[model samples]
Target: MTTAQRLPASLTPLDTALAAVLRDVAAVTPVELALTEALHCIAAEMAPLRAHPPQDLAVTDGWAMRANDLVGASSYAPLPLTAPPLWVEAGSTMPTGADCVVDAGAVDAAGPIAQVLAEAIPGQGVRRAGSDIAEGRTVMEAGRPVLPRDLLLARAAGLATLRVRRPRLRLINIPGGEATAAFIADAARLAGADVIRSDAPGRDAAAIAAALDASADLIVTIGGSGVGRIDAAVAALSARGEVIAHGIALQPGRTAALGRIGTTPVVALPGAPDHAFAVWWALVLPVLDRLLGRGRRRTQALPLARKIASTVGIAEVTLLARLQGSWRTLAIGDLSLDAITRADAVLIVPGTSEGFAAGTDVDAYILRE
Candidate 1:
């Protein structure tokens, strides 16, 4: 689609814009990777190759013996073992004919003979094979992101490698808006993408087209989405592919644009750091999450410390701070970097609502950084 219009009335709703950007997006191809290198990657498939422990084993350092042989034994009258006691440590395999373990402290070993003062029970202090993880059990389902703690389970299951999906991203800086390129790239990397960055001066259409032609799964361009004279992202995008959205009904990010260059999705963000930051999470993050097979963001319901107002038709994105065990929207005249840096979470005011009263419960998306 060509640059048909650029008016505020033409802006799309946040939800509609997100749907358009992600309608055709899919997870990247999966590949085999070493278990150590699969952190934050999405698992294609995972299963245990072997059962943990692999056999019945002792759970404590004690003497292994038949439970029936130690019956009726007590501190008053101990039962003497006919043969040498079989010594076993924790995690050691249980010997044949051994069904229980007597604590070492409760047994007196006088040379070859041993005396047990307590009765032992069958299956006591023993861990059966497959108790922790059964062979061929599913460790993780396809499209689930791998976490650090998952590696421990995978290692115990005897998995040396895993199949994962890691999407590649291309970032472009338009003209004088090179300041936030690195920051955006870092955010993309944190979202589990390999990023390649380029700079296009004076709304260079050729540079933008060249970046799109790269073999990246997604392309992101900073700046050049506004109605200003220097704005050429819309033109460049139309010249090469389709512009799905030219604007969104969002504060500090109304100029954001979404489109596609062939099969690769392209996102155009505003130049300002705060605007780009807000828009990236609101719009770009969904695309990345879909391509990486990540789950939805976890949110917490918190009461507002103060009233927050917004325009009737535009969605306002606000930063939140935890104060006195309550969340308050960061009220700033201009959406600046300093304001965002002081916040701990993100609060969204939908376009249908004009404002929220103090003490109103709202869902806040936790910010890891």
Candidate 2:
């Protein structure tokens, strides 16, 4: 038998095995795109822009005045004005010879003459030019993810277009009897990668080989990657390509195959939904980061509400219940579709000692939105 003939109980962390396969994988080239299409994307550098108000405008409804005109004004004895004070409504332009605004409600008018009830301050109740944004200010920096609210700010800053880096990725996908492989393919990894699919059985070595040869920077195949009849994924890579390592020391994802077809690395994963997810998290994910030249994925540590034990030396990945906002162990043995449907995240326990305590903190990586 070959290396692919082994099982999950005989494997290491998917990350470790993948490191061996992706030997010499290089980063792809970057491209520039418009700001709108750059949302949720990575950029190589920051862009600078600024905004300035057109002219002084009224921010409130009041009477425009020379501030000194309101001196000693009071409700009982109002100040005498030369002519009727001009009305300046909110958002109106500053009136001629006006340097301040006294609220019209503060004083009433009698016989075409208005009285001031209190004193007014210079530049008061006025929206100054560039108040919302300063001149030559950096509105949207490079490398920042474009948010929905960015457009309005950008427009206010007087920018209609943005320059950003585009993510480039190449996918190598393996098909399963079910939609599980397609589920893995649909994932947006390391920013960008087009998923490629195949329909051959897991054991068809010849068919699997042709699929890998088509076109892809990375190779991923699903099903028959584990120990079973045919074992086409293993046979395809080991015979036609280079086999880096097979089998793992983890549970639920032990049958993972790490190898290379031509110079590109290939990750063969189990067909189960949860298992495929596990391999991608442990193995394929980091490779994506390395290829894309990005940082490792970080996660918040959430304490487990329940305890769990592993059956073997192989690392076991358990589905989580997320009780009371804390990640709790899921019923693994049940493995029911409904149970998986209700799961929030998958918890991985390293293979070695028997089990862990209920209050232990486990890093629960989120699976869905």
Candidate 3:
């Protein structure tokens, strides 16, 4: 019988299944790598070795003078300086007793003395010491993915490397599931996982079982998750290790399964693109976050532009688009390729709740940076 024709024997609650998937899974060991190598990896706590702008510095290429010396000095009535003020270039350390910088034209260094024609404020055009980065403060908190802007701060602080955690993930693609496998691989990489992808030799339980490798921190098998005659991923996992959950109470991903080979966690995703996509967000992300020690995810609070009706017994994935400062519901339950492609955020409706009413303020996870 086909998967559509067969009724699931029992469905495990999404929360129960997720908890099992994360059981005993610990964060990967953190490593200190060069900034170039740590890009996109989860950042470990980083404290600046030294403060930025080690001393008071000039923010402009001009003359550095005490503000009091240049006060009330203007073009109409120039103030003659006892001596030419120190000339400092942009980013250069400001001279002692100089709390402000004046442009070149503001000071005329002709004849026997220099005349100042610009009024200056105490801190005008000056970058104070430790203003950019403090010595005792942490450069970045742990769990946020390293970004280019983060590298800028590290470079300025004279740091050659940063500590980060990158979890290794293995993706097993069953025969005829290349598209979904590739899609999931890209998404995993975007989430800072080091993805290793391989194809199962055949469709049988033995072939899928042979492809399972416990070396990776996590293993995800695509396809063969349903109860159809050809579906054998769950059986393959059971043969090698214990299956935690066979069926999950997730719309479009009900056939998904969770298991473990030895200590490494394993997840079997449905072959369909939409179904796999839902499972990736709902089930797989939690496992990935746990492995990487990610603290929190980006979420946005916005009112719903339309009402969302979902069955109370099963968890549903809702795709949304940001429009006119509110979240516009694009797809719920069975997601289409177009809807998934156009979605800017995702909201999961719990099994206990009936649905969210229109204009209800909801917190949805941001899909894009």
Candidate 4:
């Protein structure tokens, strides 16, 4: 049977529904970007350049001389210099014919005359060429996100630019009167996508089709994804193309929809601000990462400071706050902006388990820019 025919007029499992949403997603093409502008972008291939120090240099501020010249030298029987010793600073190239550096405190010098009071070994206190980074070494691997330190490494490797992938997203606000559009746009941008937003008055199919016609890599609708009469995002998506899944087994976001319009992927989020944010974080962001060729979000395990109840058959997402060195679930049923602002993490309660009690360990996904 087809995927749509398998729907049971009930909520679908979160993982199963998300898999359908991502099945049709195609990764964006890679493009060359200046190293400075490649931050947060995924690298298309291994860095091609190499970083090799050109010459051997001194690693300490001292006097440069042949090691043989300092043999048998000690404090009781100091060895006087036959000729002036060459002075070298840290990171300075060694003078010709010099094989070692004696610490400044080990040698007593006055003008052209110097006395060596300690033994020296060849190659001591010297940094060899390519010691830090060898030639032909891989600086960065493909599918790795470009970070600030990665850029520095690329520059040090003689690379002026790098090939990266950045997904372009088109956001359509169905029932556009809500104020959650801006928040959605910001979240998309934070996921390393270039976003263009459009508003459709009360689930107008024509407006959504027009936004799809703009030819973005992916299209996202912010509202009108429920069973209510005004919830027409699913119908609009069906009119344009195929609807993959209509209802996910997720609290506060069970009405989420996923589909495709021709070759482009589309995600329909619920109207409530908190529900929209939850669906975006749990479902849409993973698909966006695939299109952008980026890595998955990082998660950490933490103990719950209090009890959190949930239905046995439905997955629930709860806002988390770090209070007094422990994670506490915020009160649900309030979708206000203030609640979101106060949350530092997000906790997901699985559908198979009844719920988590105080001191039970749970995985928390930390929110970051």
Candidate 5:
């Protein structure tokens, strides 16, 4: 099972390769999905036709009255009412001309006339119209992932479904990389992709090429991307399409490759989990974002607990943990399962820069929401 070594002759810059991959790429057409099903999907603009609480509503279970009627009402000199005030429960619509609510203790109906024993202020126990959501205002913006809280607004808007762009991703597993492929597939699903996974019959070029000839917005091949004799993913992709960049300037994932099969963009990832994970963040996710029409991802700028030095001309992945309000370096270049599991954020060191100095402010993508 020993394969010969064949290193790359030249490494392509990360930015250059990324640009080439994104060239001519556009977001997928949007589709309507059930509100709950749209969670994590890239959302289209969500604006309500009308405001929630279309009319003023009572905020408490009590009698609804006009503020002016009880302005001078007090315990010693109770004000008499011509008629009993309308009763309203919490969340019920207020009666016409009624702008205040009072507890049962504040009103007495023992005599012929109802008495108000407490003063009231306008809007003291009322939820005004459009207070929860304004009409014609955007509740959810396009290109952002649908969150659970967003569903609250959707429900208020009386929306049964949401419009979203969910790209279809096909992951082809070259033999001997089932674990890595499974990991990538799960990650893609979490990113709101409709992931379809299949395995190549063998590790040969023909088997891999056959797997690459499927229809999808994006295709990813796991394993067999290196120049080793049996590593044939690059060759397989070349046979069916174009290999834009075979060797990228990325540490731990230098063997990763990018290409396209006709209109479908393809990425060849190494079998190693850490290597694949690095490329997933550094390369694959960007393409996924483009297809989803997503905007800038959430990131935080914080001072580093220590210096992170990197080799010039190669991009390196850094795993970080937020310790005492600062980023503590957990692992760099080669990542372990423990580090990956414990990571709170991720930082990518560009190939152009050597690294960041201690106490320097660095931007890192937040891993946990």
Candidate 6:
């Protein structure tokens, strides 16, 4: 009899397992790199300082003068503005002797001398330095994802580079191209991680041992990690390292393995694109945080719109959708099929359900953008 076809890919079970496992896999990657290169790095703590205007800057093109000069001046009894104040354009530095600036438009220009018709409030027309941002203030807090804007702020604080968590990344199939290593290298580039070239000695105990001896923050294995007879990844790790998880109960991706290579954590993932993609977001990411000494992180909640049938005794990470204000099932297991990321979040059918009906409310685990 022909074998029954199972669904392609999923994230739920793997995400749950990762959540549990990353807690135990502890280490931290501290990196000091230029802000330009701090792509995937996140702020480890709030910046110790904030940026203030280098000096007193102007907000508008106005005349700098003492505030008391315009107190009695009004539209009717316009004060004869004299040489005591200086005429300057917008963005010019505030003169040391001047206390405030009057908007050029606010002055009645009857001749070379401008007269003030309206009462000029003290510091009203000027932007004071240190007002928007105070020095020595904490700007970015720990656990905040480093984004382009955050980097911009860091630069403004007179920082060209920042101390950040070194990005942790693993790509299976790099040496063997079992699944496709170069593709992962490309994706890692998009994710802001520089791909570290790696290889398993020869896909067995001897090979894995030698590679483990090599310097690497993360280990990437391509192919050879499955229940199948030729799968040597599990056997190799069995010699020196224990498998944190053997089979994640998710189809196609069930072969995905998480374990240690010597002291360094290793990820043995399916070579397939969709399976690898799902595991990358659900497992590898959080595990990276653990390895880098970051506090734990979890996916934000998005509502589930549809029910999905999952295998009994197995956890299902259903890939679902939210479209036109309703939740819909997109696919079962493999989301990397060029179809699934269309949805905002993935539906996590807990490991215990057999299947679900339409309109089932389940947890939707979000992914990093």
For each candidate in the order shown, give its overall lDDT on alpha carbons: 0.81, 0.66, 0.90, 0.78, 0.91, 0.62
Q: Judging by lDDT, tell me the better candidate of 1 and 4.
A: 1
Q: Give stretches of model 3 more than 4 Å off.
A: 1-8
Model 1 clashing residue pairs (backbone):
none
Note the residue pairs that clash in candidate 5.
Answer: none
Worst 10 residues of 6 by lDDT: 1-10
- lDDT digits (tens) for residues 1-369 of candidate 2: 434355533456544665686679765454555566655554444455444566678889988888877778887887867687788889898886677878877767875766778888888988777777777666555444455566667667766565444333334344443577656766643244534555663346777776666356677777778766656677787876887877866566677778876777778788777677677767776666565555434455777687777765666667787677687776553355566678787666666556677787877766553
Tens digit of per-residue lDDT, candidate 6, span 262-310: 5667777666667666656556656665655555444444334655667
- For each candidate in turn, the TM-score is 0.86, 0.71, 0.93, 0.81, 0.95, 0.79
Ranking by lDDT: 5, 3, 1, 4, 2, 6
lDDT of 4 by residue, 279-315 (tens): 8877888888899877656776778898888887787
**Global lDDT of model 5:** 0.91
The candidate that achieves the highest TM-score relative to the unseen native structure: 5
After the best TM-score superposition of candidate 1, give how far the Cα of residue 317 lies from its true spot, in angstroms. 0.9
Residue 62 error, candidate 5, Å: 1.2
In candidate 5, stretches whose alpha carbon ends up further than 4 angstroms from where it belongs are 1-7
lDDT of 1: 0.81
> Candidate 3: minimum summed lDDT over ten consecutive residues — where?
1-10
